[model samples]
Target: MLIIPAENAVNWKRPPWVTLGLIMTCLLVFLFYQGGDSRLLDRAVEQYLDDGLLELEAPVYEDYLSREIRLQGRSDRVYDLQAFQQAREGGEPFWLAVSLLSDPEFYQYMTDNRDLLLAPAQRADWLARRVPIQEELIGRLSAFRFGLVPARLDVYTLVTYQFLHGGWGHIIGNLLFLFLLGYTVEKALGPGRFLLAYLVCGVLSGLVYTGFSLGSQVPLVGASGSISGLMGMYVAIYGLRKIRFFYFIGFYFNYFRAPALALLPVWLGKEIYDYWFAGATGIAYMAHAGGLLAGAGLVWLLGKSWFQVRESFFEPDESALDDRFTTGYAQAMGSLERMEFELARHQFEALRQHYPGRLIVLEHLYQLARLRPDLPRFRELARELMAEAANHHQPERMVAVWQEYLAEGESFTPLEAEDHNRVLFASLRHNDLKAAEKAFERLRQLGNDVLTSEACRLLASEFDKRQMSGRARYYQQLMQA
Candidate 1:
């Protein structure tokens, strides 16, 4: 099962600069810096084997494991070192080599045992060869050098490791989650608070992972923990507000509305469960859980520190746009009521231009056009009004108005070819094929191929809808012509 937020559509006004910057930085570091890790590991492994270190270290590593198990008094059998030799011969010691390299405890063991394991004559050669391998593994690899290692914890690595990724799938998945959660969180917290929360969560997450994986040598990399922090912050900020969530279980997927805070427990439980039952999948689930807790804590603390969440930002923006259009429309209508013809025309014209298909705007503008019937503006308004009314399935009312308009001394002009499609379709729809042909002929007379083609297509569709197959075919041919 997987779940993600489907909150209010993001306001792109601020452009999610920090989130985008973080993503770009991770991508660049992975592409440029982590690319050569395979080659370096290969070279280091060859050096380890060719210098005859694997033969000497395998049994010693077995002994180290045995002693650790004994100290803990666990009855777990030591995984035999026979696989190490077999792995070497089969060309598959990459994981084994990685295991040894990442282990500060094992690295320490090898250094301490060097004198005991090697002869006086061989010590110089062993020392010379092994130092390069140490540098290659612990000092050179991007993860070891920069990523969070529990045994060898450093101040800088907690932050740095969030930027380093292991491979393609790792980086892509992390970045995707980051973008999905980050944009909304950034908008909620504002950039500075968001960045602070992000870093603090990442550091806290690393600390939590350190607590869980104490004495382990594996270097943890990637933004899952920090992104997990964003997840926690996301819910906490929204709190009880019901938000949409996109969830998929097996092949079934859909969106559901739920209180934002309610999901925190679900996410926390998932991480804990995965960490417990999934075995060593190499993912840092503990860190993710820790990040979630840390992020929520940070938001809680901020609330206590006089930081009020901007509640208005979390609202769905559906009505915001509608209100803007309606407000402008209301003011235009108000101007028309006060007998300000010029002001109303200017206002309605702006609204009509912005909202071309708006029926009310066409109705009012068609009425206003009579004030200036001598102008081409009158014909343009007539075309727009009739076409829009036709599309709205109110062609009968507009056809009666067309007759009244003709009675008022307005005549149809064949030279005016613009926006003739819907009018033609309307005429066809009203069963007045003569009117449809007259409009189509006007469109053709102007030699405006674009208008003529669209008019033909509209007529064809209307005819086709009425089961007029021969008429539809004729129009389709005209379209090709």
Candidate 2:
């Protein structure tokens, strides 16, 4: 449902107001879905802290409190307040733990259902538990392992782990990244391929997480792994394509556009820094790395031809039109020589339209028209060419025109043998035996050797076409002489 405006120049035809309104609406919707409610978010934090489910340290409390409201469902503020007070008095953190556990899920659900609710943080807790993975699904997918051992892929853990986020902020951040990257990768690779790549990257990410944090009880969740993969593929395919990003330094925010490929190194550097210096709270850097590699590798292997096909759209060559026209003309001529009359006719028609009013082109068109007797407008075109030839005054060109008319059984003034031979060869590029024979007879009477050899070669080609041994032998004798 997210529609990106076309790049480079804005469409002036669309009112600027309409475009601004749509951008504002989408921004508002995104913010609302990503835990943007102030009241509900405060309540969740206070409830958890009062119930002793979360430590009430200054920075930790601030961290929990700073998360955006992610839902607009019926507020349970009164119940949360009562539970917080009761748990505080009884020295029990049961409600606080529940709040902590449920907050992540609430944020995830809000992100999934952004279009349905406009109010911020209304149904946060309702959406937290609907994870999409299942044991039966993994079991079914396991059957395609070929000769590989049938190790189970923990479908329940896979499904539940995807939902068990570290915090509201974590869930919201991952979801936002997913929304931006997932749609673009899906569009480029198509749904089926994109889906396949997504699942593979996710599974590989999980494996990396398990390898690094073996036997750890901390629940790993969020869509970062898949988002990382999308980032990799995007960078690989769109190398220098610019992406605009918002950056915050202290209290100041700035927007900048950079090539997508540049972001890859920056991202990896941040991940490396975090892994070395930051305390481990079960955020799997290895998983993110693995997902990125998988995504990039898959695109490289499967999308080579796709890149070649789409390269024209990204960068067009000015000479391509002329090259295509020349190629089309050559193919048309080949078809004509092979006697593929229909194909030749179509190609010639395209050539005529492509490059209008060339003399050589007109001659070919007229010849093709004469061959296609059933063509509805063939006679009309022939008459037109004849009229054009009549008005043309150069004797050499006129002789060529008369020779063609004579070949077609039309009346024309007679010319000497040498003139006829010169015109015939000039008019026809691939002269066959019939035309050559007439030319040869005229040349023989005039004692001309210049065209004799060419005529004999044409006669030999005709004999070969008819499979006539006698005519072939006679041509061979003439050639030796």
Candidate 3:
């Protein structure tokens, strides 16, 4: 199931810096830090094997796993290490060696029983060997050091882990949701409170995951937990207000408007369901649920205090604030899409009446008018669009429109002398000799008085430039006549 809010396609207000910063930070971490973690971790593991440090820690890790650490069937993941017990004693497994180092509890046991586990010289060697392995695990690579591990349960890892990711797919999916939900939440809460709330939600989310899998060695990474918190805040901030949402379930998708607060239960239920059914899918559903609840709770608390909900956040942006023009233009475009050219023309005509300066409406009107050149609109629209294009020094488009009009119309529009002159000038300026010839021929048929001196001179000069001396002399004679 996928659900997204159908808002903030473009942010009308101040930029959401906190959200953008989080996204950039996550991207940078993946690119610069986690991008090369694999080779470093691999070399560290190989070095651990070569140094015979596995011989020192593997036995202790097995003994640590043997105790009744956790009885819960689903929770006793420490038993997963039992298979590596033989490898621990007789053979060396790279994965088992990694797991041995990753286990904080076993490391604690190794620390507590350091004297007993190794003799003076042997202990010294083991201590020296542990440095490189630990540095790679918890220092160089963010996965073990910064990533939130249930066994380690470090305080700072909760925030740091959110910035780290597994791979390309992991960071991309998480950041996409962040952008969709983050901007609005940041706007409503403002940057300072939003940042605070975000970190708090992530910290709580980590705690929830840690509580569920206390003995697990796997380290959780990615901003998904915090991103889930943004989701909760999104629905709750709007409260009973209806908001548009786009939802998809497998092959089907649609958009609908519903009360914003109503979606909280739906999101929570989905997360909880996935947590139970798809727990082993490597997705942290519990943390997601926890983040959601935490975010909504934060909003609820903030609401009780001095946090004021900005009702104007939903108002149209500056670019789209002209509601009537925007709406009428939309209707015209919709009609055009449905093959209702007549309706589209009528709508565009109405728009032109209200907004005579809006050339786009006139442009649309001209395009629709072409369907029936027999009507006066074809000539009228062409004249208007061409004249406007000429005045704006946008002669190229007028040349094309002039050629198209010549092909369609039987005669030039009567009494639109200024428009025709503009069209002719634009055509010649655009170097379209074909359109100029057609235009001049039509004017000549209407008799000598209709042709302007400038038109004849331009035609003669253009024909001379093309080395068509016969046509040039003909226009020159017309100029004298």
lDDT of 2 at 108: 42
Model 3 TM-score? 0.59
Q: Give the clash count for model 1.
A: 0
- Candidate order by decreasing TM-score: 1, 3, 2
Itemize residue pairs with steric clashes in candidate 1. Answer: none
Q: RMSD (Cα, Å) of candidate 1?
A: 8.3
> Candidates' lDDT values, in order?
0.79, 0.53, 0.79
Across 1-481, the per-residue lDDT of candidate 2 in tens digits comes to: 1111111223244323422332343344335532333344444445445543244222232232333222322132334444555665676554554444444333343445545642355333323322221112211221111101113345555433443343457756766666556555655665556656666676666777677655333345556776677777777666687765556677776667777677677766666666655543446777787677767766777677532214322432337866877798899899988989789878888887866644566778777776644554454554455445545633344444445555653323233455556544543344344555665666666666666777677667677777987988788789889
In candidate 2, stretches whose alpha carbon ends up further than 4 angstroms from where it belongs are 1-92, 95-156, 163-171, 240-246, 250-259, 280-282, 305-481
- For residues 5-67, write the lDDT of model 3, one tens digit per residue: 775564555688998999999999899878788877787778878888876777666656655
Regions of candidate 1 where Cα sits further than 4 Å from its true position: 10-14, 62-99, 102-104, 112-125, 304-308, 316-481
Q: Which 10 consecutive positions of candidate 2 have the poorest summed lDDT?
A: 141-150
Model 3 Cα shift for residue 262 (angstroms)? 2.9
- In Å, residue 304's CA in model 1 sits off its true spot by 6.9
TM-score, every prediction: 0.65, 0.36, 0.59
lDDT, candidate 2, equals 0.53
Worst 10 residues of 3 by lDDT: 68-77
